[model samples]
Target: MTKKNWNINLKEMVKVGVHFGHETKKWNPKMAPYIFKERQNSHIINLTYTARFLSEACDFVFDGAKRGKQFMIVGTKHQTADAAKLAALAARCHYVNKKWLAGMLTNWFTTEARLEKLKNLMKKKNTGGFDQFTKKEAAILRRELNKLQEDLGGIRYMKKLPDIVIILDQKGEYTAIRECRTLGIPTICLVDTDCDPDLVDIPIPANDDGRGPIRLILKKLILAIRTGRAL
Candidate 1:
């Protein structure tokens, strides 16, 4: 990582609205320790913790990247989808920007079968094999490919389970969190006040809704991953 990247601080993060959290009424009791206090009926996350935890999470990711770890980027919420997609693309990792499949990680066998179908179809389409088929048959394969691309295009090359999972909104993407937990994969989550930090392996308390903060974090993370590769 660069010397400048190590200096991630609360001042810049606050300018990006990273300190904002859920309303007081929506806050989880378990997150009280990380809460700074309440203002205007909204719970403010501890920016001090945000700076510290986010840096730590970035370092963890860098270390893993150096070890050739594969990550599954997850941010299904409207606020975070773009950040997730950009991070995954920059890091050359798989991502789920749309809805996550129910049994994607848990039911690996069934999911792999579906992925195999996508691969075969892609191969046929690429190799001119599909030209031998009738227009109706070719159209069917094209439709299937388009549908799968919307859902699994980012991860089509993932032959095995990911080594790590990085997510923007922990509370919103609870299903992904649960599946990662089930498989005992290390997870990093941007947890808001309404979320239970305990649920994630590395919890960085910050606002998950705003695109600015998410983009900042994602950019830094991607930088760290790239640094790992160069190392």
Candidate 2:
């Protein structure tokens, strides 16, 4: 895939409000290099840097995908959850948008066990295995299935830890990032001015709270992953 074609211009980024950052008072000092200026008590991210980092991240994803590496997209925040799920689905990648269960990565054995249980429950439901149970028992089992579906639906089939993780909000998904870090998995994050870039492998400084910008970034990343898969 050609990197040039996937590059988004600064004008388009500005239109989507990607340049907007957290309030100046809340800004992280480590992010000074990515901050263009302070406007109206909020930091304005440097779109030029955003484009550069994003391109680098896309290239990395493309190469990894070509090598059959797996990825997991995470965004538990309300504004970013839907977009993350859609993007991951588009690229046929694993995702966790509803909630980031602690030890989802660090405790691989337990997590995999839970995923197995989820698969079994789903299979039983689809095969009408619940018909053998009484009404109350069936209802109780159905409730368990629903809960597992909500919590582990996206990752029900993920057999192993992902090679890389794309996080929409650095602050909101700190626990997930930490798990990745502990497990030696690389991370690509959409970090706002208030977030520390050191926490991620590739930090694409942007407005993590804006749905438009999140969707736009995720769209490009998905395209890169899809292209790699095609190879």
Top-TM-score structure, candidate number? 2
Please write out the lDDT profile of model 1 over residues 122-215, one tens digit for every residue: 8888999889989999898899988888878878889999998998988788988999999999999998888989999999888998999899
> lDDT values of the candidates?
0.87, 0.92
Off by over 4 Å in 2: 1-5
Report the C-alpha displacement of residue 223, candidate 2, in angstroms: 0.9
Worst 10 residues of 1 by lDDT: 1-10
What's the lDDT for residue 76 in model 1? 88
The local lDDT score (0 to 100) that residue 17 gets in candidate 2 is 97
Clashes of each: 0, 0
Candidate 2 per-residue lDDT, tens place, 118-224, comes to: 88888888999999999999999999989988999999879899999999999889999999999999999999999999999999999999999999899888888
